[model samples]
Target: MPPNINNTTQLAQNSDKMAAPISPEETLARFEELSVLEAEFEDAELELIRKSTALNEPLWKKRAEIVAKIPHFWTLVLEQIPVELETFIQPTDFQLFANSLQTIEVSRFEIDDPKGSPRSFSIKFGFDDNEYFFNKELEKKFWYRKSKDWAGLVSEPVKIVWKKGKDLTEGLTDAAYDLAQAKKTLAKTSGGKSKAKAEASLPEYKTLASKIEDDTEGAPSFFTWFGFVSSYRWISAEESEEADKEEKTRLEKLKRGEKLDDDEDEDDEDDDADYQETEVFPQGDECATLLAEDVWPSALRYFKQAHEADDEELSEIDVDDMDQDDSDGEIDIRGLVSKGRTSSTSPPSKKQRKA
Candidate 1:
C-alpha cells in the first residue's frame, strides 16, 4: 500500500512537470501575429509619407505663385497708368522721366527694342529681394482689355461725341443729332459742371476728331461710328490715393539704396522662359486654408508606430545579450518571451547529450 501511494505521488509530480504555461508553437504564433501587425504598420506609414509629399508639392507652388504675382500687378499699374492721366503731365516730361521709372527696383521690365517706345514686350516684377518674380506679355490684347476695365472702374462717363460723316450734307446732319443727344443727356444728369471741364474729360474726342478730318469715307457704319464716341470720365480719387500710397512706399525704399537681387535672374539665361507667376489669390482668411500643418504630424506618428511595432520585445533588454547564443547554439526564446512560466523538463547534461 505504501509503494502504490509513492508511485501515485511521483506520477502527479511528472504531470506537473509536463505542463508548460506557453508552448513553443504558441510563442511562434505570437511572433507571427506581431509580424503581421508590424507589416500593417509599415504599409500605413508608407501611405502617410506618400500623402504628405503629394500635399506639400502644390502648397509650395501656390505660395511661390502668390508671392511673385502680387508685385507684378503693381508693376502694370506703373507702366500703363500714364495713359489714363496724361492730361495732368507734359508728354516731354513723361519721356524724360521714363528712365526714372526704372529706378524703382520693385519691378524690372524690358522692351523688345530698348531704344524704341514700350508699346509691346514682356515685363517682370521682382519681390522678396528678387527671390521671386512674375512675368507677363504686354501684347495689344492685354492693353485693350486692361484699358477698358480700368476706364470702367476709375472713370465716370462725362461726354461721348461720335465722329460725324465726311460728306457735306450728311456730316452736318449727323453732327447736329450727336450734339442734341449730348445736351439732352447732360441736362438729365444732376451734376452741374463747366463745358470746359466736361470737354477736358473726353480725351478720345481728340482721336475721333483727327480720324474724321482725315477720313475720306462718306457715312461711317454704326459699328464703325461707335468707336468714334469720345467717352471720358473723371478718375476715382480714392483708388488713386490708395495706389499712390503703395507707389510712394516703393519710391522711398529706392531712395534708401535698397537694391533688388539679381543672382537668380533666369531672365539673363533664358529669354523664352515662362516667368509668369500665376497667382493663387489669397485673401486674409483664405491664406490659412492652404496650410498642410495637420497632415505632417500624423505622418510622423504613423512612422513612429511602425518603428515601435517592429521591436521584438515589449520590456527593456540588453541588445548585446540578445546577439549572444545560448549553449545549444540557438537564440534564447525564454528571454524573448514575456515573464510567465510553468514547470517543464530540462535538457540533458553534456555527457548525456544524444549523438
Candidate 2:
C-alpha cells in the first residue's frame, strides 16, 4: 500500500527535512533584474513605432501637395481665358498651372436645404480661388447652422476633365520614382538611420490620405472619406510560427547539452516556476457535513486546539490554578501530568508521587 498522506501537523513536525527558505536579499535582487529587463524591452518597442511613423509621414505629405496643385490647373482652363478661346487653349496651359502652383485655399460647406432638394442635405467642399463661386459670404451667413445653401450662387460652374495633365503627369511620375528610390535606400539602412532619413524629408503640412485614383470623377476636393496612409508594425502568422519553431529548437539543443546563449537559457528558465503553489480547504464548508460524518476530523481538531489556546490565554487565571507554575509562559506541566495520570489508570510514577 502507498504511504499515508500526512496532515499539516505531521508536515510541521517533519519540516526539518525540507530545504531552508531563500534569503529576502536574494529575492529582492531577482525582482530588480526583471524590472530592468522589462524597461529595456518597452523602450525598444517604442523606438520601433516611432521609426515606422517617421517613414510614412513624408509619403503622405507629398501626396497632399500634389492634390493641392490640382485646383490651379482647372482654373486656367475655364476662368483665365474667354469662353470663345476655350477650344484653342492647349493642354500645356494646364501643365504650366500645375507646375507653377505653390499654394491654394479650399473651402467647405454643409447645406441643410440645397436648391431642388429641401428635404435632403448635402456637403460641398473644394478648391475655388474666387470666394464668389460659393455665394461670396454664404459660409458666414450659415455659420451658425454650419450650412451653405444655394442662395450663395454667384458664378457659372466650369467643367474640368480629370483625365489629362500633360507635363504635370510626367512630373508626378518623376516624383513617385524619386520617393520610391528614397524609400528603398532607407529600407537598406539598419535601425535608427532609416528613421532619421525619413524625418529629414517630412513636409511642413499635415498630410492626410485621399486614396485618390485617376478613375474618380467630379471630385474637386483634395479631401475624401476613403482612408489615410500610415505605417504599422505587426507579426504575420508565418513569422510567429517561425519564432515558435526557433524557440523549440533552441530548447531541444540545450536539453541535449549543446551550448546556447544566456538569453535562451533565461527564457526557458522564466517559463518554469520554482515552486508549486496551491490553495486547499482541508475542512470544507457546511455543505460537506452531509457528505461524510467526519469530513475532516484532523482539521477540526487542529482548529479546536488553536481556539482553546486563545481561550486559555484570555482566561489565564482559571487555567493556571489547575496547572503548575513555571518560568515558561505556555508549559502547563501540572495540568499535563494530571490529565495523563487520570487517563492511564496505572500506578503513579516517582515524579508524580513526589508532586
Candidate 3:
C-alpha cells in the first residue's frame, strides 16, 4: 500500500544493514568532536593532501613554505572561527608522542600481533625543539590498535596525531551566552522555548543543542535519518546557484514561452543528475559539511546501523531453547575451554614445560 518502496536505494540500504548503529548523542558528539578534533584531523588529512601536492612544492624552500602552510592554516582557522581559545604542543594520553616529529618512524614498525591488515608503525621523531623516542607500544582506540615500533633519529614523518583536547568549556563560554540569549529571544518571541526550560538547560557539548536543555528533541529524530532527500536538493541547489543567477537575466526569453536551448536543458539535467548521484550515498562525502552545522540531528542523520541489523538478526535467531551452562550469572564461558584447561591430569606442553 505504501507505493511499493522497493527501489535500488532501498535494496542497497537493506543490504547494508551491517552498517553500525550510531546514537543521536553519539552523532551530536561526532559533529562536535569534528569541530573539537578538527585541528588534529585537518592537520592529518592536510599532511596527506600536502604529501600529494609534494611536486607542486618541489624545492626544499618551497617544501618548507608548503609545510609551513599547516600551522598557518590552523592560525587562520582559529582566527576566523573564534572557536579555539589556544593551542599547544602536547600529546593526549591517548595520542602517539612524536617529539621526533617524523611520521615516517611510525610507518616502519610492526604491530605486536600482526594480522591480515597489518597496521605497522615506528617510534622515533625529531623536531626543531625536541625528539621523542619510544619502545614497544602506543595505544588503542575503537578498532585501531596504536603501537610504536623501533626507535630511530628523525628520518621519516612521525604520523603524529596530537591527541590533546581543548577546554571547549572555555572557548564555548561565549557560545553558551549567545545560545542562551538566542533561547531567551526565542522564548519571548515563540512562547514555546520556556515549555522545555529544564531540558533547555541540558548541555550540548559539540552542538548548539548542547547549549540548550535536553527537554526538546533538538535536531535529532528518526524522520531525519530515513529522510535524506533534502541533501540531494541541497547539492543540486549549490551547483545551480551561480548559473541560476545568469539564467534569471536570460529569463525574459524563457518567460515569453521561447523554446529553451538544448544546452541549457542539458546543463539543468546534468545538474539534476549530479545531485541524484550524490543522493545515492547520503552519508558519503557530500554530507560531510553537514556535520559542521550548528545542530546535527544525529538520530535523523545517523544510527548504529550495524547494531540495529544485529538486533534484527538476533530476533530471527531461535536461541530460546538454548540453556546457559552456568548456574549463576549469564554463563561460565570458561566451561567451553575445558579441553584446553590445565588440570592436574593433563601434562603441560613443551612451551610451558620450562615454567
Candidate 4:
C-alpha cells in the first residue's frame, strides 16, 4: 500500500513538470493569436479615420473659403512647416511656393471606395499662373498598399511639365518620369524579366542614373517629390491583393502549427534587394505623410506659428536696435524714469528729470 502511494505521488509530480513548460509551437500559436488581435485594432483605426474624414470635410471647405481671402495663407503655413519637411524645401522652392502656391488641399480620395483604404489621400497644389509650370493645379495621389516585401503609401511620378529655363528640379523630375515609364515599357517588352537585366538597355534609366550621380546638391528640391515613386518599387493594386492573399495563407499555416519554408523568407529578402534605388526624394513618403497628416490638418496652427516667428524676429530686432542706440551713447528717458521710480532712495537730478 505504501509503495503504491509513492508511485501515485511521483506520477502527479511528473504531470506538474510537464504542464509547467510550454512548447515552442504552442508559444508561436499564442503569438499569432496576438497578431490577429493587432490586425483587428488596425481595422478599428481605419474605421475611425473614415469617420473623422467625413466629419472634417465641411470644416475644411469653410476654412478654404476664409483662407482664400488671406494673402499668402498657404505660403505662411508652408514656411512654418516642421523641420523634417523644411529640409526638402530649397530656397528656390520656397520662393516659388511663396510666389505662386495659392492653395494647398488634401483629400482622402479613396474614403468611400470599399476596395480602397481611407489612408490613401491626394495632395493638390493650386498655383496661380506661374512661370515654372503651365498647370493651374498639380495633384499627387498616394495609395496605401501592401506587398510581400514592403507596405506603405506608393505613388507614381507626377509630370511637372516645366516651363523653359524655369525647372526647379533641374530635370530630375523629367528624368525620373522617363525612367519610370521606360521601366514599364521594358517590363512589358521583356516579359516581366528582372529590371536589372534590362536596365542597361533603357536610355532613360541611364539618363536618370547619370543625373542622380552628377547631382552635387546636398538635398533635392521639394518639387522633386512630384516625381516620387515608392521607397521600394511600385506595387500595383493587383500585385498587392495577390500578396495579401499569400500572406493570409501563410498566417493560416502558421496558426495551424505548420512549418514554414525557410526559402520563403529568402525569396522575400531577394525581392527587397531588387528594389530600384532612387536618390531623388528617397524621403518622399515621409514628406507626403507630413503634408497629409501634419501640414494639412493643422494649417492654422502652423500659420499662427509663422506669425509667432515673425513677432519673435521683430522683438529681437527691437532689442538689437536698443543695444545699438546705447552703444551710440543715446539715453532713454522712459528707462531713466522707471529706474528712478524703482530706486526711491535716489531722487532724479533736475537735469535728469528734464531729460
Q: What residue pairs clash in candidate 4, if any at all?
A: none
Per residue, candidate 2 scores C-alpha lDDT tens digits across 1-355 of 1121110112222225575555554454444444445445644754554454356447535644664554332232222233223332233332222333233222112222122211111122233233112221111001111011111111111122122342222222223233334544654663433343352353311111011233233312211110111111112223334543654464465345454453332232222321101001111111122111121112234334433443344324233333233432233422321232333343323232233
The sequence of per-residue lDDT tens digits that candidate 3 reaches over residues 170-239 is 2223343344445445546653322334324434313433332332322221111111222322221223
lDDT of 3 at 208: 38
Compose the digit string of candidate 4's lDDT tens values, residues 1-355.
0021111211222236457756554555555666556566778999999999989999999999999998778888887777888887776566577567889999999988876789899999999987788988899999988876567888988888899998888999998888888877777777544546566557887787778778875667789899888877677787778777876676676567676553354443335333455546777888999999999999999988765554444323222222223422223322221222232233323231233
TM-score of each prediction: 0.15, 0.16, 0.15, 0.76
Score residue 5 of candidate 3 by CA lDDT. 16
TM-score, model 4 to reference: 0.76
The number of residue pairs in model 1 that clash at the backbone is 0
Off by over 4 Å in 2: 1-19, 22-232, 236-242, 257-259, 263-355
Per-residue lDDT tens digits of candidate 1, residues 1-355?
0121111111212225666456544554444444345545645864664555456547645544553443222222222332223222233222222212221111111122222212211112122221111112111010101121132111111122223332222242234234435544654573543533443244333333444455554322211221122122222334344434543443454345454232232332222322111111112111111111222223234333423332323333332343343433223232322123222423222242356
Scanning candidate 3 in windows of ten residues, the lowest lDDT window is 149-158
Best by TM-score: 4
Worst 10 residues of 4 by lDDT: 1-10
Q: Distance from true position, residue 193, model 1, in Å?
A: 97
The C-alpha lDDT values of all candidates are 0.29, 0.29, 0.28, 0.72
Order by lDDT, highest first:
4, 1, 2, 3
Candidate number that wins on TM-score, 2 or 4: 4
* Model 2: colliding residue pairs: 110-147, 135-152
lDDT score at residue 218, model 2, on the 0-100 scale: 34
